[model samples]
Target: MGYLEDQAAVADGLLSLYEATFDPRWLDEIRSLVGEMLTAFWDDGSGAFFDTAKDQEQLVVRPQDVTDNAIPSGTSLAVDVLLRAGMLLGEPSWTERAQRTLERLAPTAAKAPLAFGHLLTALDFHLGPVVELAVIGDPGDSQTDRLLEVVRERFLPNRVLAAGAGPGAIPLLTDRQALGGKATAYLCEHFVCQTPTQDPGELARQLDAFRAKALAS
Candidate 1:
């Protein structure tokens, strides 16, 4: 009944939902579920998640799986979700926990990446070029729609998108505002932002340039 995989799966879904909708409510739910997952499934001594919660009825041995099977292992998926959500939601604590999880499993994953495919995928995201895009304007406006379309269509791996009218609500949009009262897109990496752009074509060029730079590095 207290399965770590089930909880992690739900958390992963919630994370995807948040990305798609940019709804703060989904982020709140993710935070709550992640907190509960840590409290219930985390092994303090090993710093990895157990297959079952501590309070569950004990078998001969509690399983702690790190290898990826047909699907990503629960621990791997949990780490993936945690890292992404942490970055998007500005939760240092969640990111820290995810880092610890990766550190704990790094040795094994390094030696046998094939056995930990999902974990390696997660690690790639951690090490890869991650872009955070913020779009600001009236959500219902045509300009805002065009900007959002450019963002959603672009093929950037390990990307996070946040769109809204103003800055007061979403943390990612804290200081972001429209340029000249027109819908604008801001592309950032490692917390450094580029000049905000209103034209979709300009945004696309900037994104391509950013990816090129990332690849070069």
Candidate 2:
């Protein structure tokens, strides 16, 4: 019985892999998985996702459970990952779907906070300001590592990190240049960027200011 209950969690794992490795392949896989998830579980009329695939054995009632217990609900994980990967990839449709799902669950989540802990966290990412950090540098460069370290050491939750030599195929990395022929960092909020910097200290200051502003809101 190949039930499609954990696809959202699987997509989340791929997102984590992308963050850790900075390999676009993981993101690509996420995109592909998202398509499958939508096709199999998404119900436009209900604005919810079922745990079982559409092609699976028909039951008297399709199971659609969204509760955060020992493991986060598939719906919550789906929304979180969709928001994260969707923003990074510049895909508005994915975020829109995730938002609609949250819209349906908002009142329920409000009344049952303990049961919807993970879903609330996902909502935070949706409602909070998200920082987009694009680090452009050739691989194995110490300058690049330093700039990344400044960002990695922080406990920034609503931030997305994209690192590579150039824009490559990532929309977040596009148009971000390496100033002065050195490793550079571009910090943006909701895709509107700040001045690019090659120094790690300046990057840290920028991230700190951005974090401060995010908190202020």
Candidate 3:
């Protein structure tokens, strides 16, 4: 294995793959990766993740930085994926660990906004009102594509998108089904879901209302 960021990037990429293909295997892979990430990088005493894994060669100090450069810092990316994975898998501990890390870094991040760009992104997700969107349909279906398009049309950073069907699927997709045998989209926040809609237009409207409701709060 490489460093914490490498593993973080892989988990994030698997989440993206799961969203695009709705493949359960990718979800499984992500679960495994997250487990490894926690085992190797998490600092129990500090509640902050280190850039190097536990098994890496001994060094005077374990490097842990939260500033964003060419890519997100390892700490920032770790928090980002943990929050998304927690929502996707219905595992609150993952989210809790991420929250602890953010709590430690929040003061530093607040002081240097430009350097902690991705860390702030992760913080925004943790604060509240992050969107949890789950669409149930075949990846190949054109109607499914239409609904997915509406979701991807705009930039919604605080959102987790999962599209798949059947039992043993990602938690976001489990027990969800198409409305009236048509591809359906479910927009949820804090575990409460609005009416499921299959029409792209209705989906768009519901998204707007949901977003507005979140922003209003």
Candidate topping TM-score: 2
Better of 1 and 3 by lDDT: 3
Those runs of model 2 whose alpha carbons end farther than 4 Å from true positions after fitting are: 1-5
* Candidate 1 local Cα displacement, residue 211, angstroms: 1.4
Candidates, ranked, TM-score: 2, 3, 1
Question: What is the overall TM-score of model 1 with all chains considered together?
Answer: 0.92
For candidate 2, the 10 contiguous residues with the lowest summed lDDT are: 1-10
lDDT of 1 by residue, 48-124 (tens): 78889878998999898778989888899888888887888788877777788898889988888889998887887
Cα lDDT tens digits for candidate 3, 1-217: 5799999998999988887787788988998999999999998899989999999997998798768988998888999999988987889999999999888888887787899998887888888788888888887889999999999996687898888655475677778888777788988887688888888999899888878877888
Give the worst 10-residue stretch by lDDT in candidate 3.
164-173
Score each candidate by Cα lDDT: 0.83, 0.86, 0.86
What's the lDDT of the predicted structure labeled candidate 1?
Answer: 0.83
Please provide, for model 2 over 27-111, each residue's C-alpha lDDT reduced to its tens digit, 9 standing for 90 to 100.
Answer: 7798899889888888888878888888999999988789999888888888898899888887888899999999999999999
